[model samples]
Structures are given as structure tokens and as C-alpha cells.
Target: MIDSHCHITDKRYNADEVVSTFAEDGLEAVVTIGYDTATSIEAVRLAEKHERVFASVGIHPNEFTHEDSLDGILPLLSHPKVVAYGEIGLDYYWDEPERDVQKRKFIEQIELAISARLPIIIHSRDCDGDMLPILKSYAPRITDGLVMHCFSSSEELAKEYAKLGFYISFAGPITFKNAKKGDIIRAVPDDLILAETDCPYLTPMPHRGKLNYPAYVRYTIEKLAEERGVDFEYMERLTTVNAKKLFKKIVDFTGEKI
Candidate 1:
């Protein structure tokens, strides 16, 4: 299995220890996301030190500010370990940075991602009303790939994104008792679905309230299999295939055929 998105750069966990356990955890690879320049650099460094780890770089909506520029981030994209361009997108759930500013930065990064020819990892919260149209408009140019990371949206929204050929990645939240994501999980086409841990946050059940790590991604996959009425092994293989397809750099980096 592959953890399609996570933040091993987050201070709560030791990055080296996390990567070391990939084999025992049953993870084929994991893409650690960057929400700002500092973490983005760290993500690349980690990916450089670990073969099974990969990285994505871009400013997240909540982390963006007027003075923040993608100048530092742009260089990181050239790194062989950097497989995608974001955890970038809108977040109206927060009250700072203003919605328009987030939107502007989001577009700028999207254009950057397109030019760089890398897949984009998105994070949208309470802003899908605006998020959908923007993604639709850029779908043609986003030929590299795209994924709605840690998705906890409606079934209709999931289908809409799938229509655009964008992947829908589910995180630990899908394992919650009241998640009510069965339909949403089933709604995603097998080829368009992916799984993640989003570690140090949103840990899955049986370990939900504790610190999360990539290994725990198995719980999310288990929940996905349950909802879709497939076995765990099938769900695992399906997500791993979908993840490698979307993040093609993983194939280029490891010379692993999908």
C-alpha cells in the first residue's frame, strides 16, 4: 500500500523513524506534503534520504500570506524526489489571509504546477463551492495529474472530481464511527481512489485519538474496503495502483512498473 499524502515533516513525529518502518508497516511508498517553503525543503531532504518516501511542495491556503511567494518552492520542484506540486488549495474554515488572497495564490501555484509538469495535491475545506469551478477550468492544463487530498466532502463533489480525472484520496477520518462516508467511498471509481494517513493528525479508529503515522494508514484502507464491499488486499492493491498512476514520478524515481 501507499500513503498518498502525509506530513512527516510535522514536528510531532521523528521523520527518520517513520520512514524506517515503511516495510514493516506494509507501505510501498508515502508522499509527504509541504504546506510552506520550510517544510517543503524538509520534505525533499527526507525523500532524498529515504527511497520509499516521496515529496510534494506548495503553500497551503491556511499557510499562505501576502508576502509569501513560490520562488523558494519552485526550485524544490526540480528535485527528483519531488513528485507533485501541492497540498495547495482553499480553506474557508480559517478566517485569516482573506478568501480572495487564498484564491489568487491557489491559481498562481496551479499555473506553476502545470508548467512544472507535476501532479497537484489539493486540500479543500468548506470552499468546494468555489473550488470545483477553478479545478474544472484548469483540468485540461492539469495533464500531469491531480488529487483531492484527505477528502471529506459530499458524494456529488467526489463524482464531480472523478469526472475531471482527478483522484480522490481518503485519510483517517473515513474510519471514524460517524464518518458516514460509505456512499462517498463507494462512489469513487476504483481507479480514481487513493488512501492516506495524514499522520500526526486524523489518526484512524483503534488508534484514532493518538498520534498517527504511515503504518496506521492500513486502518483507512480497511475502512475503504469495508465500505466498498471488497477485501483489504484488494483495496490495498487498488489504492497502490491508483497512487502510482497519479504520482508517476514514483515510477520514474524507483523504476517500478505500475
Candidate 2:
């Protein structure tokens, strides 16, 4: 299985050791996401050393600052292991500034994602109205594609994203009791589904509150398999296929070159 979104670069996770040990998690590939220039650089650097890890670079909504530059993000895409761009998007549920700043930064990041021509891993929260315009504007410009990371919406919202041909990525929240994400997952087409840890934040059930590791994603995979009522192997294959398409770096670095 693969973890399509995770902040392995976060200091709380002790990224240096975790990145080295990720392969032992039985993961074929993992995307170590970025929320700023420092973490973006860290993401790519970690991907460079580990075959099972890949990188996505972009800033977060809450991190928005007038001083933030598109150049802070653009250069990371040059790295061979950098398969995607972001962890970037609007988040109104938490600390929020004026709507204008949030909108401006989100668009700027998407524009960078377009220039880089890489998939964007979005962290949208409680600002769908504000976030929708940014996504709708550039639906056609990028080649790498897009994923709604740790999605926490409904079937209707899922269908909206599905129309854009975006993938719906599920994290530990999906496995939580009475999760509000059930309809969202149910609505996603099989091929458009992916899994994530969003590690150091939303650890999957059975290990909730523990420091998340890539290996713990196994629990999430099992939970999803049950949700879909399919065998575990089938779920694993489907997600790997999904990941390979969006994060092509994995197909190049994963496993022995048969």
C-alpha cells in the first residue's frame, strides 16, 4: 500500500529517522508533503535518499505571509523525487486572516503548481466556497493532477471534485468511529481513491493519538477494505495503481527494476 499524503518532514515526527525507516513499513511509496519553503526543501531532500519516499512542495493557508514568494516553491520541482506540489489550500476552520489574503496565497500556490505542472495535494477545510474558485480556475492547466488530502466532506462534494478528475485521499479520520467522511468515501470512484496518513496529525484508528508511522497505514488500509467489502489484496492493488498515476516518481524508484 501507499501513503499519498504525510508530513514526514515535520519536526514532531523526527523526520530524519522516520524517512530512513519508511521502507520497513512495507510501503511502496510515500509523499512527504510541504507546508512552507523550509519543509518543502526538507521534503525533496528526504525523497532523494529514500526510494520509498517522494516529495510534494507548497505552503499552507495558515502559513500565508506577504513575504512568501512563488520562488520559494518553484525550485523544488526540479528535484527528481519531487512528484507533486502542496499541502497548500484554504483553511477557515482554524486561524484565518482576511478572506483576501487567504484567497491570494491559495491562487499563488496553484499557479506555481501549474507552472511546475505537478499534482497538488490540497488541505481544504471549512472554506469550500472560497476554495472552489481557486480550483475551478485552473482545472485544465496542470499535468501532474490533484488530490484532496484528508478529505472531510460529503458525497456531493466528492462528486464535485470527481468532475475535475481529482482524487479523494482518506486519512485516519475515515477509520474513526462514526466518521462523518463515510459518504465522501462512498461517493468516490474506485480509481479516484487514495490513502494517506497525514502523519503526526491524524493517526489511524487502533493507534489513534500515537505518533503515526507509515506502517500504521496498514490499519487504515484494512479499514478501507472492510468499508468497500473487498479483499485486502484488491484494495492494496487499487491504491498502488492510483498512487502510481499521480506520483509517477514511485514507479521509477520503487522495487527492483524488473
Candidate 3:
């Protein structure tokens, strides 16, 4: 299985130790996301040090500041281990960064990702009304692809994104007792479905309240299989295939057959 999105550089966890456990946990690979320039560099460092870990770099909406520039992050995309260009998008849930600033930065980064020929990993929250239109406009330009990370939106929105040729990644929320995301999980075409842990945030069921790690992504994948009415092994293979399809650098860098 592959954790399509995670934050191994979050400081709350020992990044080295987390990567060390990938073999025993059965994780084929993981894409550690960067929410800012500093974390982006750290993500690349980890990816450079470990064969199974890949990296995505971008400034998250919440991390956006008037003076923030993608200059630092732009260069990281050239690294062979850098597979995608985000964790960037709108987050209206937070009141600190003005909504307009978030939108402007999101667009700038999307254009940058396109120019770099890298897929983008989005983080949308409470701003789908605006997010949908923005993504639709750039869907054609984003030939490298994009994914709605840790998606927690409605079934209709999920389908809308799939129609745009974007992948939909499910995280721990899908494993919650009352999530009722079976329909959402099934809505995504198998080829566009992905899974993630988004640790150390949304820890999956049986360990929901605890600290999360990439190894726990299996729980999310198992729940995805249950929701899609497939066996665990099939779902695992399906997600791994989808992840590799969207993040082509994984296969290129590691020469992984999966």
C-alpha cells in the first residue's frame, strides 16, 4: 500500500523512525507533503535519504503570507524526489489569512505546478464553493494531474472533481464510525482513487484519538476496500496503481514496478 499524502516532517514525530517502519508496516511508498518552504526542504531531505519516501512541495493556504514567495519552493520541484507540488489550496476554516490572499496564492502555485509539469496535492476546507470553480478553470492546464487530499466533501463535489480528471484521496475520516463515506468512496473511479494517512492529524479508527503515522494508512485503505465492496488486497493494489499513475515520479525515481 502507499500513503498518498502525509507530513513526516511535522516535528511532532521522528521522521527517520517513521520511514524506518515502512518495511514492517507493508507500505510500498509514501509522499510526504510540504505546507511551507522549510518543511518542503525537510521533505526533500527525507526523500533523498529514503528510497520509499517521496516529496511534494508548496505553501499551504493557511501558511500563506503577503511576503511569502514560491521562490524557495520553486527550486525544490527540480529535485528528482519531488513528485508533486502541493498541499496548497483554500482553507476558509481559518480566519487568519484573508480569503482573497489564499485564492491568489493558490492560483499562483497552480500555475507554477503546471509550468513545472508536476501534479498538485490540494487541501480544501469549507471553501468548496469557490474551490470548485477555480479548479475547473485550471483542470485543462493541469495535465500533470491533481488530487483533492484527505477529501471530506459531499458526494456531488467528489464526482465533480473526478469528472475534471482529478484523483480523490481518502484518509482516516473514511474509517470513522459515522463517516458514511461509502457512497463517496464508490463515486470515485477506481483509476482515480487514492489513500493517505495525513498524519499526525486524522488518525484512523481503532486509533482515532491518538497520534497518526504513515504506517496506519493501512486502516484507511482497509476501510476503503470495505466501502468499495472489494477485498483488502485488491483495494491495496488499486490505490497503489492510482497513486503511481498520478505521481509519476515515484515510478521514475524508484523504478518501482507497481
lDDT of each: 0.90, 0.80, 0.91
Summarize candidate 1's per-residue lDDT along 135-161 as a digit string, tens digits: 999998899999999998899999999
Pairs of residues clashing in candidate 3: none
Could you tell which candidate, 1 or 2, scores higher by TM-score? 1
lDDT tens digits by residue: candidate 3, 1-258: 899999989979888888888988888899999999999999999999999999999999998764487788877989998999998999999896899989999999999999999999999999989999999999889899999999999999999999999999999988888889888888999899999999989999989899999988899989989888899999999999889999998998656565
Regions of candidate 2 where Cα sits further than 4 Å from its true position = 255-258
* Full ranking by lDDT: 3, 1, 2
TM-score of 1: 0.97
TM-score order of candidates, best first?
Answer: 3, 1, 2
Clashing pairs in 1: none
Please state every model's RMSD to the true fold in angstroms. 1.2, 2.0, 1.1
Tens-digit per-residue lDDT, 1-258, candidate 2: 788888887777677688666556677778888888888888888888777778888888887753457677776787888988888888888665666787788887788777777788898899988766668777777557899988887778889888888888888888888886655667889989888888888888898878888777777777778888788888888888888888876677774331
Model 3 vs. true fold: TM: 0.97
